[model samples]
Target: MHALVGDAVRKACSELFSVELAEGQLQLQKTRKEFEGDITVVVFPLTKLSKLSPEATGEALGKFLTEQVAHVSKFNVVKGFLNLSMSAEFWKGFFAAALKQDDFGFASPNSAPHVMVEYSSPNTNKPLHLGHLRNNFLGYSVSEILKAVGHRVTKVQIINDRGIHICKSMVAWKNYGNGETPESSGLKGDKLVGKYYVEFDKAHKAQMKALIKQGMTEEQAAQQTAIMQEAQEMLRLWEARDEATIELWTKMNGWVYDGFASTYKSMGVDFDKLYYESNTYINGKEEVEKGLAAGAFFQKEDGSIWIDLTDEGLDQKALLRKDGTAMYITQDIGTAILRFRDFPDLAYQIYTVGNEQEYHFKVLFMILKKLGFEKADQCYHLSYGMVELPEGKMKSREGTVVDADDLMEEMATVAQEVSAEQGKLEGLPEAERNQLFHIIGTAALKYFLLRVDPKKNMLFDPKESIDFNGNTGPSVQYTYVRTQAIQRRYAEAHPGFNPKEANSEGHTLSTAESEVVAKMYEWPAVLRMAATTYNPADIAHYSYDLAKLYNAFYQDHQIVKETDEQARNFRLALTYKTGVVIREAMRLLGISMPDRM
Candidate 1:
């Protein structure tokens, strides 16, 4: 309807005003609540072409649209704006067509070029945390949104499995673990590893305090700490493939990987492939040497390879260290090029890293472009802001970060509490009830993390997220369940009822029904915007608004109880379609909706 009205206004300009509508000249918006039309056309831009006052231009366009556009039933001019209301036939026709479309508001699968999304690139030193939660959810949701809009998406992550961070965990465990494995400790492997990482920090800090008291500077003390030296030596040993070091590294990394798989399952996110810095850094070294040979990078006297990008508004960045070792950026470069090589048809890749790495990616892309990668310009950095709890930002070294597993469990517990208070799951079996709680809890966590703009730092409140009255996940889930409940009641009342069999042409939609249809009508546009921006928050808010509109419509309208079969079936169709859209939109956010929640 928006497109139809915009075209009508353009035609009116060409025919009635003798002007071609150029790009961005035709402006259409939803009419304000007090207006008498479904869409409002801004008349100010058209006034220049019409050679008349805004009011006169609007009046002329309104009259012309009504006469020529079939869906433009009537129009009114208020001040300088033209408000056009669509015909009832137009609204009902779309509703009927939408009901028959199994892929309504979604593009055909794989209609777009292949794209890869890299997210949740966690270091093996620790378990996943609140920050990892946001990263994984955002990346997964963006991948899903792109898929919905016809993109062939590849989900991947480059695990920081080999680093000084992981070495710290290994060193602490070796020195102080007493051979305590995850099984012996009855803890998750990643959690057990994370404990040693924290232990390393504590021991290192205590050593720093003692050294500072012994007439040493803080920096000297930091480097001289025994635990820090142990981690550094462990890293060197692992690099040399020392048998004992390699054995411990493999065993500990195995534990962390097992723990990660479990957490990812509970969080409902998955990857199609995994990349490791241990392997990619080798590729990065080869690439850096090639860049140097091609004059894209230069080597310093100390044997470090660096890319000079001062002309590109970025300073020189090191690709290889003075000791000829790969830096963090080096592995990133390898990972990016490796993905393009792995997926030959990939149009580009999106890196879902935090906002702090904005400069890093800029330099990386610039270097790639300089290195003559044709698709370098097509790459994207989906940088998001840090997530903070009410208590504040998390720190992994201090072990104050909110563990992802513990937080997920807390959310489910909160869901159980909220459901018990409402008495919504009274009759369910224990297993089924538990499933509902998981669904509801996971939805709340994902929705709250995703509802805000991706670039904005957000503070999460667990209690607020579970509230059913506000713009929370539970509220949207409740509305979807309500739609299902309405259909169930209708099905029981009329055992053979089918919304498809009803003749909707005979039904006149009430104002409430019209509003619901209007909200649903915006789904396609909302979905397109989300795909373009790579933001799941767009889909998140759209689901909430659609759910809100449907709940409002259901409050005063009768479906199964209506005397008119045409009206009853029409309302039932509305109910059915609302549930479909809500379910689909939430699914893109990597959230599941329970039927009875």
Candidate 2:
């Protein structure tokens, strides 16, 4: 539609003003809601060529387009804006064509850029949390959106499985667990391990307090705590591959992996490939040595390797400590290099990380580029804002964070409660009811998190997200279900009804119906914009608007019972197209729409 309008505007200019305008010079936009048109032409850009006032230029172009363009039925000049209303016939044909497409809004797979998205890098010490939920949804949705627009996307995550954090969980579990496994305790593996992590903190804090009571400074006390020292020694032993330490680490991490798999399944997010820090940290150390030999990094007398990024608006950062243990960036550098090597065709590598590490990514990318990895320029830090509860910021060590598993269970419980009150699916089988609740609850969670702009902090409210009337996942899902109900009844009344066989030519549409069709026409463009910005919020809002328009049309017009055959068929076709688009849009956000919710 945009291409058609662009060509019409260029032709109008050439014939009326004898001016040839480049495509970029001819600015076009959707007509403002208050305006009486489907597409708007910015007349101010062409006034110089026409040698007339803006309004006069708009009038001339509008007059020419109305006569020359077949789809453009009429036009009106509002100051410098030439608003053009497309023909009703054009909209009817547009919706009919849409009904024939299986992949309505997605572009065909092509030779576009192959991109890699990295997200959900959870630590093995604890279960996933609300923060991880946001990261996973955003990364997954962005990958899907990219694919929708013809980019080849690879979903990947680098698990932080080997670190001081993991060691903390192991050290506490071994000392105090008494061999309490997940099976014996009736707890998920991640939750069971997290309990020990909290225990470790409590014990370490107690020791620090005792040392402080002995007149030791806080720093001195922190270093002198027995629990802290033991954890540190455990880390050393694990790094040295001590048999006992390795066995303990392996057992605890296996539990975490099992727990994480369940949570990820419940969350409905997945990765195509997984990278482990245990496998990548050694590569990072080797790379650091190579950097040192190449003069890209320097080693101090204390045996710590450092990169001088002071000239890059940052202080020097350590690559390796005196004990030669790798830091966060060390593994990240190694993982990135390994990814590019594994997928040499990758044109972009996006790291979906929290904004707190913005500087870390900057230094990593700069170091990579300095070491002559020219592809480092293609690295993108998709820095998103944090998710905080209404009470306050979360503290993992204090165990205040919202556990992802618990939150999901709560959402399902809330969903079932809301579903029963609404009485929409009461007659379904128990198993189906349970499945619907899971779908709606998970969709609600994903939609609420993805609806906000990625760079903005969001306050998640479980109750608010599951509402049936407002802009939410369930509302959109309900609208789709409503459409399905209409289809079912229509089929009952007219058996063997095939929409493709129904003739919709020359059907006159009411204003509300036309509005619905107009919004549907905007889907492809909205999808493209979402892909370009790498923000699922764009698709989320678009889905809401499309659903809202369909609801309004459903309320104001007749569908299954309309006496007029042409009007009823056209409405059914519109309904069918709306369902397809809603499902597709929600799918791009990693959301599922239940058929009967």
Candidate 3:
């Protein structure tokens, strides 16, 4: 519809003013609600070509559009805006075309550029928590959106495998566990590792407090703590590949991977490939050496390597420590280089990370460019704010973070309770009921996290997220179920009724039906905007708004018992397509809709 109207408007300019339509002149948007039109074209920019007032330019364009464009049935000039109402024939024609096709608003697979999205990059020392939930959902949804728009997207994550944090867990587990293992303790491996990480912090704090009481300064006590010293020594040993330390590191990291797989499975997110810091840092070290040799970086007297980025308005950043160990940024540099080398056709590499790391990514990209990687400018940081619970902030080192696995289960339990109270799953068997509960539960969880713009800090409330009456996943699911019910009744009553049989030409649509069709017409545009911006919140809102529109139309009109065949079939087709779009939109958000519920 936009293409047809856009071309006509341009043609009108060429014919009327004998001037080419400039790039920014023809701006079209959804007509404001108070206006009686489908779409509005801003005429203020066109006044330059028309040599008339804004209102006069709008009048001329609106007059040309109504006569020249078949879909533009009638139009009005509201000051500088030309509001055009599309004809019923055009909408009905669109409905017929839409009915004949599936995958209506999506582009063909791999038709666009190749891209890579990196997310959920957790360290080996701790289990994933609520913060990881937001990261995983955002990354996964963005990848899905890119795919929907025809981009070949590779989803990946880099595991923070070698670090002092991992050493802390190893030291604590070795000293506290007299050979106790995850199997022996019957705990998830990541949780067990996290428990030990907390233990290391506790013991380090206690030792520091004891030393401080003995007249040492705070900094002196921190460095003198016995457990801290052990962890530091263990980190050095791991870096040197000492057999005992390497064995412990590999075993514990393996445990964490197992635990992470289970959590990711429950969360419905996955990676195409996993990059390990242990491996990538080796590459990063080599790159740093090459950079130092090439004078892109400098080596300090202490043997630490650094990049001077003050000219770029950032301070000098350390690439490697004095001990010649790779810093966090060093590993990132290696990963970026490795990925482009691995996927040579890559158009972009997006890092889905927290807003707190915005400056870190800026430096990383600047450093990548300085290293002479031509594609370094294509790197993007999909920075997002934090997700907090109603209580307060959580601390992973203090053992106060909400575990992802436990939170997912709690959401499922909440779904089950809500379902039972509403009698939503009465006829289903136990197994089916359990599966439905999971779908509804995870839908609630993902929707709540995704519906907010990624740049905003959001408070997540499980109770609010599960409501079927609100602008939520389950509400959209319920609307989908209603669509299915209409089709089922039609199927049951007429035996082989095809709604498309009545897809022939009709009266210019009544006001109610046109409003619904107008919203549907906006789907492709919404998809394009969402894909370009890499935001799932746009799709989330589209689904909710679509569901609301369908519900409003359903309440105001009769579908199964309308005496008019054309109207009934039109309404049925409308309901059916609405369901299709609602399902697809929610699917991109990683939310599943059940047929019955």
lDDT of each: 0.89, 0.88, 0.88
Predicted candidate 3 versus true structure: per-residue lDDT over 1-597, tens digit per residue = 777888989999999899999787789888998998888888888998899999988888889889887879999988888999888778877878877779899999999999999999999998999899999999999999999999999999999999899999999999997887889999999999988988888899999999999999999998989998898999898888899999999999989999999999988898999899999999998988998898899988999999999898889999999988889999999999999999999999999999989999999999998899899899999999898767656766545677799888987888888888888779889999888878888888898889999988888654454454688787888899999998998889888777656653554466777778888888998999999998999999999998888888888898899878777878888888898999999889988888886
Candidate 3 runs further than 4 Å off: 14-19, 48-51, 390-392, 397-400, 461-466, 500-504
lDDT of 2: 0.88
TM-score of predicted structure 3: 0.95
Clashing pairs in 2: none
lDDT by residue for model 2 over 1-597, one digit each (tens)? 788989888888888889899756788889999989988999888998999999999988888888887989889999899999899789878887888888877888855799999999989897889899999999999999999999899999999989889888888998899999999999999999989988988998999999999999999998889888888999899899999999989999999999999999998889999999999999898888999999999989999999998888789989999999999999988988999999999998999999888988999999898788868898999989999767667887656688788888877888898877867677899999898888988888888889999988888664454454588888888899988889889999799887766877757989889898889888988999888888999999999999999999999888998888888888888888888899899999988887787
- Residue 228 miss distance in model 1 (angstroms): 1.6
TM-score of each: 0.97, 0.96, 0.95
Which lDDT tens digits does candidate 1 get at residues 57-173?
988888888888898898899998899899888888888888888789999999999999999999998899888999999999999999999999999999998979999999999
Cα lDDT, model 3, residue 436 = 84
Model 1 is weakest, by summed lDDT over 10 consecutive residues, at 460-469
Select the stronger candidate by TM-score from 1 and 3: 1
As a whole number from 0 to 100, the lDDT of residue 524 in candidate 1 is 93
lDDT winner: 1
Q: Model 1, residue 205: displacement in angstroms? A: 1.0
